[model samples]
Target chain A: MPITRRRLLTAGGGLALAGATAAACGSNTGRGGGGSGGSLSHWYHQYGEPGTEQAVRRYAAAYKKTRISVQWRPGGNFDQQTAAALLSGSGPDVFEVNGPTLDQILGGQVVDLTDLLKDVKDDFQQAVLAPKTHDGRIWGIPQTVDTQLLYYRKSLLDKAGVRPPRTLDELVDAARRLTDRRTKGLFLGNDGGAGVLGATPLHAAGLSPVTADGKVGFDDPAAARTLAKIRKLYEDKALLLGAPADWSDPSAFVQGLTAMQWSGLWALPQITKALGDDVGVLPFPADGPAGKPAVPVGAYAAAVSARSDRKAEAKAYVRWLWVEQTGYQEDFALSYGLHLPARTSLARKADRLRQGPAAEASRFAAEHGHADPLLWTVASKVAYQDALSRIIKDGADPEGQLKAVVRTTEAELARVRKRS
Target chain B: MPPAALRPLTSNTTRRQRNRTLWFWVFVGPFAVGLALFTYVPLGWSVFLSFFDAHNTVTPTDFTGFGNYRRILSDPEFRSSLTTFAVFTAIIVPATFALSLALALAVNRLRWAQAFFRSVFFLPTACSYVVAALVWKMSIFNGVRFGLANTVLGWFGAEPVAWLATTQPPWYWLVIGTVRLWLQTGFYMILFLAGLQRIPVRLYEAAALDGARPGWQTFRHITFPALRATSVAVALLLVINAFQAFDEFFNLLSDARGYPPYARPPLVYLYYTALGQGQDLGLGSAGAVVLALVIAVVTVVQARWSGLGRKEE
Candidate 1:
């Protein structure tokens, strides 16, 4: 009790010890109970569609078994945040990934969810399941399939006397002819088609992202030529450059800023609401002798974390929300945004998708759709995308860029192979 | 026996020193612990992780010594990011220094509404970088005819240009540079204003009496030289800040698709490599360590050149 120096030192040390003990006892991340007990943390990237957050939260609220806390991570950094959180052992117990990456699959960041789909595996679309599987184990449950293709205004094309392009050259010419004092021909993003169309040209040229044996599949010379055609569109300034929104939203097309825009099936409802029957859908047109018209199909899949302490509960939550709940799945795909139901049966039963541009889009997706290879990592994708940007925006030699990308892709493939 | 009186004084002095020491520990101890825990611990852990094969996990048993460093060094993308950083620094540092100094000089010379001008100029400093980048991307520099820049160009019968696109002219540099300048120059201007006010009025009067010209000559002889210390400090800070630039570039160019390869700073690139889908923390940590070294060397070299902490003669 005396104000002695020794007493002060002792008191300080004791306080420090007590503080450390309290801090250690506290939760690392403020959102606790993901590891144990009655609560679970579910994360989804901020979907651009209105009511997406409300809808996901509504679904979470319906689950009576466990208290599900949904963290709607905003912006494009969801993958980064998920990866970091997983590494730190503080990530969501159940989460949504665009698809399971090689890192997530190989490193055991995601648990094998094939057990959830065992009985109903045949009902789900194979294209949606392919990217989520590794070594015959499904790492994720397909929630919604987003098909990226071209959306054009029928009225604008009719006014300009431009038919829906069936070939890459025709698409370019149509884009050129549609440009005038006000409206530009097409919009493929602010980067002049780099973000969305980067891989499209490869698919348009009939090149696979990766070979069946896991080799770099986009190294052919024809791949470069297809990209060069995109550059021609850029050079002509026919492609609508920067709009308020990027190519993801159908804003450019709906606002009549561009006659045609590259967007996903998710934007179909908004586009239909804005333009009605005047809107038309087309696959990115075929290029070269071996080419076929193509649509890039991607899916947002629900994956449970392997490192989650409550793995069984998380899996049950995933299974309950994505598997047993067909109504919620259909609503997630159709009501909030227009995406194809991951279940083939649900897609078949959906009356809305059976008519109009949706039907055309679904047909194109089945006929000409190309899903990215499971072996192709995000690093390879970034490299390939950068090559496309350089080719289209900067007039860099496509052959050279593609060659460089091949090296990067091969290295990534080798790394994955080594790990596996 | 003769020094007995002085012994009590000595004892009192010792007690006062002890009390001061105890108070110092009380004030500084908590902050020192926090600094160690938050900053130094992570820094040390990062260095340790740089030598491991930490792909998706932080704790790793596989020690791949120098492999991550080799990969980062050999990576063309990382090298390209370094080049981008260098170009950004070269553009931003001089432009910011000159503009901020000019603003300070202008505001200092104003006899009326100086406070108003200062506040007006300083307001952008309060705006978040992400918000400003969004405004710049969505409204001002957007390539559409309705965008502010394009609309202005339209009045002159000019075609709308994609200001952020990697076109032949590379107008994105202008957009990035201008936003940073607008955001940062005000803060530095305030620093220069403080430096300006600190100068003795007698020196300027003496310079005027010595037949120095009022505008350029007096500025060169008196004003510029007097503000050397502030100038050095500001330039050093600007250089470091430029190297660490992230939020604006990340917000403006990056999206769900990807970042354009051209303007990616090291930190953004590292964020993607270490934390993005690749989740290769080892390689990312190596890049970070290398970046930190580069920043440290640059800062030291700049301080040496500018004589930043040297005593004025």
Candidate 2:
């Protein structure tokens, strides 16, 4: 009890160290029970407006038989939090996974959902499910399908006397008509670099840089044609080059500075909030010999942690959420408007989404979406984009650039295969 | 009589020696434990991992002796990353030293608000690197029409420059250097300030009495000797930081794949290879070991040249 300097210093230092460690490794589980009361903790990136919390609560209450608690982490940076939690063994029992960060998370023990999905495997769309499988095992259920669509200013399109294009040439004509010195036709101003350039075009061409077997098999004349079109657009001054990258906001398009923009279904709520009546959505124009329009599909998946102490409980929750819960689609629709339902049946039900341009866009993307098969390998897609972007931006020879990328990608694929 | 005298002396010497030994252990024990736990232990683990095909997950690991190192030497991406890191360090180290020294001199001359100026200069160091990078990415150096840099350029009738997007020479170097300078100048400024404060006033006074100008006086008497230790410290810190420049590149320039296009330093590349892209921990470990040796050799050479190991007068 004596206040000696030595004792005080020792106690203070010990307390400080303990506090630091706790802060580093602590879980923000005040809202959810961690396995107690038969509760399973779930974490997801925040979606939609203020009404989203209500929808989440509604879903949780309706599915009370499962005794699962959904705790929403409010931010777009869920990957960082999830990574830290995973490293510390305190990650959510059920969490979301993006395409690029999937391999990193899987390096840790992620649950194999083969048994869980066996009962309801046929209910989900194949396009949605394809990206979530690895080595013949289903790792997650696709929660939402995100496919790129062309957002255009309805008034501008009407004034320019143009309809949404079905082919690359038609798109260029439409773009030229809409473009002026003051206002450009399209904005592909990517801040990160050429990866953004390759995704849409590659998806449209149906040429993924990596195969399911982890081989580079994406060198095609279709890819070359897509690159050539992008370059021509850039050279003709029909495209704006300095807009903010990730310009998913429809306000810019609605404002008429940019006549057209490329974005996914995730931008629907914001677009509706900003420009409610003056927007239209169409699939990305195709350039292949088949002339079938294609849109790039992005998706989020829900996977249970392999390290979860209660795998049965987690699996039960997943089954209830994906299959048995009738209100799941409605919850998603109300929370994040324009989100494409992963289930084919729900997407076919037109009443699920809001009655506006967003609903039409969601329908278009869902029906015509094509995801790049390189979704499993992170490096090859990046390398491909880097190569593609250089060719477009620097006017490098398309064939030579594509060949170089193919070579690098094949080598990288070989390395991955050898190690695995 | 001689035996009796020798007995007391021996007893006294033995007690003193025991006391000194106890003090030495008391002073050194915590550091020894810390070094073992934080530094030596991880280092040993990395070295051991270098000899094996380690995975990030808790799977059964296989021993592939020197395979990772051999692969790293042959890997083109690894080679590119090493070259990038070396270039970054070479440019940043000298620039930071010169700027910090200049700032320190300017602050030393100011008779008012020295603390205020120092704090103002060091404020950037207080921010999280991610926050700083994001701010730089969105507001200051944004590529859009309304971005600060672009707006400024527009006023001069010059076209907007895509500072972050371009892969060309001066633009890429400028962006990297600006970010590096923003974070590092403050650290080196503090170091230089401390060194400047330690110089004796008598030397400056003597120079002034001899009709030496302030600039020449500083150069000949105070600045040269004062900066010896500070230069060594800054060089070593810069080398370590350059090798570990992950947060800036990772946050600002990174693609969705977690590899930056133009600015992938060796550490960022290692991270992308290990956990982000390939998930090849074996090659990543090899890259890491190579980076560590590079830093170690650089620091040792810097210390030797700067006389950092010499005893002070």
Candidate 3:
């Protein structure tokens, strides 16, 4: 308490050193509970929309059986953080993932939820459960169903005297026709549309890239043509290049940067709020001769870590939150941003998906939504991504690229099969 | 009396020596621990991991024995990513060096407002690479009609260009490379300025007296030679820094899950392999080890070429 020079210097130096350490190490005061009082800890990647963190906390607070601590980690490097945490055996008891990869399931990191799924198996949509169900044992319970599709400006198309394209060739032409001094027609995504391009063609062709077996589904000549046809859109300058937002964000479409954009169902409410009746939705139009209009369907699944100390409690929490608690599931799906409930019964009954693009999106997702095969590996995906980028953006031969992809895909499939 | 005095002196000397030894360990301990924990340990573990097929868990299962290294080398994406990084460094290093040197020379000569100008130039260094990337991507070079670059293009009767999205003509390189230049030039400029100030005033006066002109002559005869060591160090740093390029490329040119082939650098490629959907820690660790070796070799080559350790008379 003395105001001496020695005391002042000591205090100041100590405070400065402490501040520097905190800055360098980035305050380890994370939000998740550190097992104080033996509470259950859950982790979620930070959602962009407001009230999501609070909503999760509100759910955790409702559970009086145990104190549940939740950490809403900042997005961007969530995968790295989650993986590192899980690897160290200090990860959350319960967490959510886009879906369990073959690696996660094979690594024995995720616990099987077959017991929870035994009765409620048919209640969930099959497409949503495709990734979660591997080796005939369900690993994760479905959390939210997200599907990607094209959101178009009906008014802009009408003014330009263009109908929504039903085929890849038509899409190319329509994109070119819709182009003017003011607007370019389509935006699949900023990175030469590679985000959607790799999967959409397969989806449109009514084929998954890799089947349950290792057979190549996207090796069709028409699929090759579809890849090549995208070149026309690029060559003609019909595609809008870079926008601030990615495909997940509806900002580009709402702002009228492009007349039509490939976006997700999660953006339905946001797009409707922004553009109202001017918006219309369609699947990634058929790319191959035998294809149908299709969309890429994805979902986040609640998984209990095998390494969790409270594995049983974590499973119970997951079951209660994602399965038994139907009301919370609906709220989680629709109230914040639009995502169809994983439950088929609840999804169809939800009022938001009862009409318009919401209804259409849900219907299409149920009927035609394509999930990337559970066995798909990063190498195989990259092979397709590179092939697609080259064919569309760099004027490479599509058939040749597809063949190259087939070779790589087969190799990767073999590697994973042997390893897993 | 002499014996008493000698013992006291010896004890005092011994205490001073002991204090110095204690201080040395105290100061070096934290840094030594940090280096081993974060850097050396990780590197060693990574080398160990390169031999096996690891997944989500750091603990590897299969003993692949250089399989990851062989596989990655054969993988076209990894090879191309390395090439892309090489090209990126080639373009960025020279542009940054020249611009920084010019700016430094200009700042060093200022009789007044030198601090103001230096601060203005150095302001960009204060901004986060990711934040700067977003600004560049969203506002300045965004494909929209009202973007700053587009607005300028429109004035010149050119169509608004989708800078980051374009891959055919490699226009995206222009956008990404420029942001790298803008974000980095300031820090390097400060270095050059420091180097400039260290140059003896007599050298410049000597050059001036020897009929060395103001523009190039002064720089060629005096400034450039005096800053040779600094230039070599800056160049070496530039290459290493360029190889670690991630934040700008990642933020500016990537989608939800991965970067396009054109935008992929070696580190990003490794990330995709290691952690992206498949979560192959083995391949990623192998890639990282290989990359570290590459960086080490490049640094050594540069240091040797620049005569880094050779004593200059």
Chain A TM-score compared with the true chain A, each model in order:
0.92, 0.83, 0.91
lDDT of 3 by residue, A1-420 (tens): 559975676567568668978896774434233454567778898887777788889888887777788888886767666766677666778888876777788888889999987898999878879778877899988888888888899999999899999887788888999988878888878766766756777767667788666677777777776777778888898888777777778887888888998887878788889988998888878866578887778787888878787777778788888888898888888888888898988987899898999988988887778787787766688778877888878888888988998898887777677866
Ranking by lDDT: 1, 3, 2
lDDT of 1 by residue, A1-420 (tens): 569986787688779878987987884452474445557889999998899999999999999888888888896678777777887567788889887787878787889888899899989888878888888899989898889888888888899898999999999999999999799999988887778875678888888879878888887989989989999999888989878888888888888899988898889988889888998889999999999998888888999887788888889999999999999999999988788999999999998889999999988988887788798888888888888888888999988999999999999898888888
- What lDDT does each candidate get? 0.88, 0.69, 0.82
Candidate 3 lDDT over B252-281, as tens digits, reads 877666677787888888877776766788
Off by over 4 Å in 3: A1-36, B1-9, B201-214
What C-alpha lDDT, on a 0 to 100 scale, does residue B303 get in candidate 2? 77
lDDT accuracy of residue A153 in candidate 1: 86
Residue A4 of model 1, lDDT score: 90
Which tens-of-lDDT digit does each residue in B37-123 have in candidate 1? 999999999999999988888888889999999999999999999999999999999999999999999999999999999999999
B62, model 1: CA deviation in Å?
2.3
Residue pairs in candidate 3 whose N, alpha carbon or C atoms collide under 3 angstroms: none
What docking class should model 1 receive? medium
Error of 2 at A331 (Å): 1.8
iRMS, candidate 1, in Å: value is 1.2
